[model samples]
Target: MEAALIAFATTAATLSVTVVLALLEFRRRRREAVQARREQIVGRVLDTLERATRAASRAPIVGWWAPNELEYALLLPRLLAELPEQDNAVATWVARRIQHLQAATSRREQVAIGADVAAKVVQWGR
Candidate 1:
């Protein structure tokens, strides 16, 4: 009877340890998946902003705004707000993007000026 009890206790301990390990592993994997998804989203946004900035670089002197540049400028703030603040790298990247886009306000192009005004109008209002 003592031997049986010992065996049962050993089995229960092992099972408990295994369950704990499995839970830990699951939590680890879930965190990694969330981080991976966040990276993918950030990458997609970077590609889009890159394309828009490229188009905006060729902005005309007189217009309400160059559509692509305007889009890039406007999306900066929303994207900054949308990303999780817990990730320092993401926050740093977004800060740099905001700085880069701020150059629009300094450009001589009318489209750039319009982009600045539009961004101010839409973003500053809130």
Candidate 2:
């Protein structure tokens, strides 16, 4: 009976240690995943902003309007993707700018301005 009790206690201690190690590993992995995702999202937003800026700069200025269109399909997703979830003020500001850009006839010019607006949001968020 004494030997059996000793074995049981030892096994329980070992199991507890293993569980703690597993939990720590799981938390570490989750943190890594979240960090990686944030990096990816930031990269994508930066890329979009860079592309739009380049496109706008390269576009022909015609009668106070840029010739190039703002390619909503490309811009919207990346902007929304980079936008953090918790900040309603930032989100609303961005949403309003996007709405204006979407409604504008000179989308390229609008998008360039939008990038400035987005940069402000990024600054605020950080």
Candidate 3:
């Protein structure tokens, strides 16, 4: 009977450990999935922004002539919102750039802000 009890206890301990490990692995995978999704969103937004900036630079005028600001403004805020609280500097910089891009009064101002935004987006990729 003692031998049987020891075997049962060993089995129980092994099962418990297996369960704990499985749970931990599940949690880790879930976290990684969430992070991947976030990065995908950010990447897409940045790509769109980069394309917009390129288009703007090639255009004759830089004011509201660029048709991308409306879409960019909408997408950028969402990306910023998804960023972790620890990334406040990035969030703040993007927010300020978006605001400046939107409020730019002259063609020169728009061009300058667009250049800054392009440079920042490139930096973020690294």
Name the best candidate (by TM-score). Answer: 3
TM-score of each: 0.56, 0.61, 0.66
Give the TM-score ranking, best first: 3, 2, 1
User: Which tens-of-lDDT digit does each residue in 12-97 have in candidate 3?
Assistant: 99999999999999999998987776567567666766666666566466535667667666776777677777776776787788
Candidates by lDDT, descending order: 3, 2, 1
Worst 10 residues of 2 by lDDT: 63-72
Candidate 3 TM-score versus the reference = 0.66
Q: List, in order, the clash count of every candidate structure.
A: 0, 0, 0
RMSD of 3: 3.7
Error of 1 at 101 (Å): 1.7
Q: Candidate 2's error at 38, in angstroms?
A: 1.6
The residue-by-residue lDDT of candidate 2 on 1-126, one tens digit each, is 999999999999999999999999999999887666656655555565565556555535542353223544565555566655764455466557656655666656666676776587557635
Q: Which parts of model 2 are misplaced by more than 4 Å?
A: 59-69, 78-93, 99-126
Clashing pairs in 3: none
- The global Cα lDDT (0 to 1) of model 2 is 0.63
